[model samples]
Target: MTPKHVQINKQIKLHFALLFVSCILATYLSGPSLSSMPLLQWLLTGLFFAGISVLPLLFFIPTVMAPNARNLSWLGFFLLAYLVWGVVKIFSPNGLIGGLLVCTFILTTFFYTVIWLRPLKKAAKARQQLEQD
Candidate 1:
């Protein structure tokens, strides 16, 4: 494969890794006290629903925004959403534990933002060099 293809693949792999790790960490930190359901069932259901909900935004939003600005704006939106969710959960019947889990999701979002931005910077630099050449 071409270097560009390889780079894109690498970036995609890194993104997936970030998503996976963040999900795991969020689950762990959120607490084990899920509503008496089977663990695999809960995990699969959540993953499926979240993927369905999030994937479209993930795929389309970057194309809508300028490439350099996309990562920052996306991260900001994600962080804000998570914070709002946390606040709502905190005040809801679920209370503090749910709030803490939402906070963990916020932290995970931050980590993903950092990882994503690093590669985005590198990709930008690579593009610049290609333009110069």
Candidate 2:
């Protein structure tokens, strides 16, 4: 795989892992307060993060690992939406656990933004010229 593809793959994996961890952390931290509706609360927390992180990921995976992958700049906008949410959470009053959860969300969104901005075509062109020698 090309270097750009490698970077994108790594970023996706990292972001997904972080999102999952954030979901679990959120569920745990809010569990007690949600004791009456434990199942629903946890499920919704997980689903919300999954929807923001994994759902858009579907559009990225097919081309993320391909050398000639077309640029999906549009995906970055979707990710930015999550970033905004994270920022809002960070600023909002919350306890220690809530702070950590927001941090994780921020990290995931930052990495995704980096992935989306990768100079794929430029790198591909450079690689192609080098290979033709």
Candidate 3:
């Protein structure tokens, strides 16, 4: 892979990690803004909120590092779930900077995935057609 390809691969990983962290932050950071909850309580609340919501991403670590069009497509679909969560969080009570942050990261990640996948897919399609000749 070229340097640019490698850069985007690393970025996809970073984005997922950020999304995971933002899920926790959306809960932990917002609660303090609305209430006088103690640090530990808010922390646990954040952990519980993030538990099942974004954990599936852990399964994609290896695939994302060496992404192919097919695997990236699968991950793209998975990111929709996060987009929904981010949108919901946008208007939900705890929604605040975290909601926006989550949405921002998700979009950036998806954009990069698409940019990476497009050429690979086109090349694959071209190669398949040539093989048929």
In order, the Cα lDDT scores of the candidates are 0.54, 0.56, 0.80
For candidate 1, lDDT tens digit of each residue in 16-97?
3444445444443343445767888777766665565345336534432333346555654766665665666566563466
Which 10 consecutive residues of model 2 have the lowest summed lDDT?
Answer: 63-72
Give the top-scoring candidate (TM-score). 3
lDDT of 3: 0.80
Q: lDDT tens string, model 3, 6-60?
A: 8888888888778778877776665554356677776677677677666787777
As for candidate 1, its clashing pairs are none
Clashing pairs in 2: none
True-structure RMSD, every candidate: 8.1, 6.0, 2.3
* Deviation of model 1 at 115, angstroms: 2.9
- Among the numbered candidates, top lDDT falls to 3
At residue 109, give the lDDT of candidate 3: 87
Regions of candidate 3 where Cα sits further than 4 Å from its true position: 32-38, 128-133
Give the per-residue Cα lDDT of candidate 3 at 83. 89
TM-score, candidate 1, is 0.37
